[model samples]
Target: MGRARFAFGVLAFGYAFLYLPIAMVIVYSFNESRLVTVWSGFSFKWWQALFANEAMLQAAWLSLRIAFASATTAAVIGLAAGYALVRARRFPGRTLFGSLVVAPMVMPEVVMGISMLLLFVGSERLMGGPDRGFLTIAVAHITFSIAFVAIVVQARLTDFDRSLEEAAMDLGATPWVTFRTITLPLLLPAVGSGWLLAFTLSLDDLILTQFVAGAQSQTLPMRVYSSVRLGVDPQINVLATIVVSVAACALMLSGWLTRKKV
Candidate 1:
């Protein structure tokens, strides 16, 4: 009983450590004070300001579009990579290939951002196309996001029963049909989780976005960072509240989907 109580206490403390600041941010989102540290009275003025700020609104919308596109593109490519890693066991470069697939997950974001920046700069010099903007940021995000999705899918596939695929094939189904009808449904939970992770990563990213984002393509986080650098505006609190709400919804939806699929 004592040990159980101690464990529960630790768990509660851990959760408080993680969420207390977030709770404070949510509560202060309505504060009338311009300073985040001070709470004057509750007001919706900040929400109005957030809506009125055209630059911030545009940045937020652009960020969402980039995140959605990056997550989807990453999911597709990562799914194929993971499938190959699992199914093609006898390939010559199988070991190197597997290592490369997961390398980004462990790599530093700063390193990745710099590397992608250099790649984009070189590509521009060579092709004189796809300039530093939405396309570049989305591609950079997809590069890192792919590793995360590949890891998730690979884990799910590792323990999956091959008999299901084999059984479908024996019933005169083609490889594509078997994968679409039988294999994909079982892998939906992992894929959805990966997509959600990729989306969240793309949305919350700052350093990587900074390296690739052009002047006209600033994202919400970049906007917020610039604003906070000048001063903590009440509108930033409102923006944080909105972003947190959206992220929470995505997480809950992913959980529901996973449970339903399982």
Candidate 2:
């Protein structure tokens, strides 16, 4: 009983530690006061203000578009890479290929951002194309997010039953047909999860965005960070609340789908 009590207490404490700040932000988002610290009363003025802020709205929309593109690209690339890693018997430079794919996942954001910046600059200098903006940011996001999707898909594939594929093949299904009819369906949950995770990572990323984002390509995080430098406002809290709510919903949906798949 004592050990159980201790475990419960620790769990409760950890939950509070993580969520209390988020809860406070949600609560303050409704505050009537312009000042975030003091709650004047419950009001929708801040939400109204947030909606009225055209720059913020534009940045949010741009971020969403980039996230969607990045997630989709990452999912496709990661799925192919995961399949290659799991199914291929032998390939040239396999170790180097895997390491390169995973390098962005573990590399520090500052280093990754700098490296991406240099690569973009060099590419532009050589090709005289692919300027830094929305497209570049989305590509950079894909580069980092692919590793996450690959890891998730690889984990799912590692323990998967191979006999299922063998049986399909024995039944005269071609490799492409079997994969399309069986493997893809089974891996959909992991693919969806990877997309959600990549979207969230790209949405929350500020350091890399700052490095690659041009004057016209500000994302939500960049906008919010710039606003906060002037001082914290209730409008920023409102934005934060909206972001938290959306992320929570996505995560919950992903978890439900994964559970259903299992």
Candidate 3:
């Protein structure tokens, strides 16, 4: 009983430690103060200001579009890579291929960002086209996010039963048909999880996006960072609150979907 009590106490402390600051941010978002730390009664003025900021709104929309595109593209590529890693046991250079698939997950983001930036610039010089903007940012996001998605899918695939596929094949189904009708259905939860993770990563990334993004393609993180550099405003609090709310909703929805699928 003592040990259980101690463990519960520790868990409570850990949660409080992690969420206390976030709680403070949410609380202060409603404060009617230009001075962020000071509370001068509750007001929706900052929320109003956040909506009124055209640059912030545009950055948010751009970030969402990039995240959606990147997550979808990463999911497709990652699913194929994961399938190959699991289903192909005797492929040529399998070790090297597996290493390459997962390398980006552990590789330093700064290094990846710089390398991608150089690649894009060099490609532009060689081909005399393809400017740095939305497409570049989406491609950059996919580069790193694909590894995360692949890792998730690969984990799920590792535990999967091969008998299901074999049974489908014995029933005169083609490999593609077997995969689409049997394997894909069983793997839907993991795929959805990977896509959500990729989406969140793309939305939260700053360093990589900074390297690839152009003046006209600034994202919400970039805008928030710039605003914070000039000192915290009430609007920044409102923006952070909105982000936290959206993230919470996404997490809840993902949880619901996972449970329903199960």
Candidate 4:
């Protein structure tokens, strides 16, 4: 009983430590007062103000576009990498390829951001394309996001049954047909989970985004960071609430999809 009590107490303390700040943020987002330290009852004024803030709204819209594009591209590439790692018997540089695909999953954000920045700068100098704003940011996001999706996909494929594909190919279907008609449908849940995970990573990324984002390509996270530096607004709290809600929903859905049976 003492051990159980200790475990429960630790769990409760950890939960409170993580979520108490988020709960405070959510509650303060509705404060009627300009000063966040004091609550002056609830108000919808901040929500109205958030809508009126054009810079924040524009940055949010741009972030959504980049996240969507980056997630989709990462999903496709990660799926291919996962498939190759699992399904293919042997290939040249298979070990190196697998290592490269998952290296970002454990890599530091600062390291990745600096590396991506240097690559983009050099590429722009030589090829003279993709500029430094939207395209560069999107590509940077994809580079990191791919690792997450690849890890998710590789885990899913580890338990996958290859007999279904083998049976299809054995019966008169080509490899491409078997993959499209049989494998893709069964892998949809895992793919969806990976995509959502990648989307959240890209959307919430500020460190990496800061390195690649140009002056015109400010994202929602960048906007929020700048706003907080000047002083906290009720609207910043409101934006935090919205972002947290979105991220929570995405994570919950990703968990659901990951657990879904094929």
lDDT of each: 0.89, 0.91, 0.90, 0.88
Best by lDDT: 2
Candidates by TM-score, descending order: 2, 3, 1, 4
Q: In candidate 3, how many clashes are counted?
A: 0
> Candidate 1 local accuracy as lDDT?
0.89
Candidate 4 structure quality by residue, lDDT tens digits, 1-262? 9999999999999999999999998899899998887998999889899999999999999999999999999999989888888878798999899889989888998998898989888988899866888889999899888887777778888998989999999999998999899999888888899898889888889999999886678999998888888987899889889989988887888778767775
lDDT of 3 by residue, 128-207 (tens): 74799999999999989888888878888898888989999999999989999999998888889899999999998999
Candidate 1 lDDT, 74-121, residue by residue in tens: 999999888898888798988998888889888888998899899988
Best by TM-score: 2
RMSD of each: 1.5, 1.1, 1.3, 1.5
Tens-digit lDDT string for candidate 2 (1-262): 9999999999999999999998998899999988888989999999999999999999999999999999999999999988888888589999998898788899999998998899888988999868899998999899999999998899999989889889999999999999999999999999999999999999889999999886778999999999899998889889889888888898899998778876
Ten-residue region with minimum lDDT total, candidate 2: 81-90
TM-score of 4: 0.94
Candidate 3 collision pairs:
none
Candidate 4 lowest-lDDT run of ten: 253-262
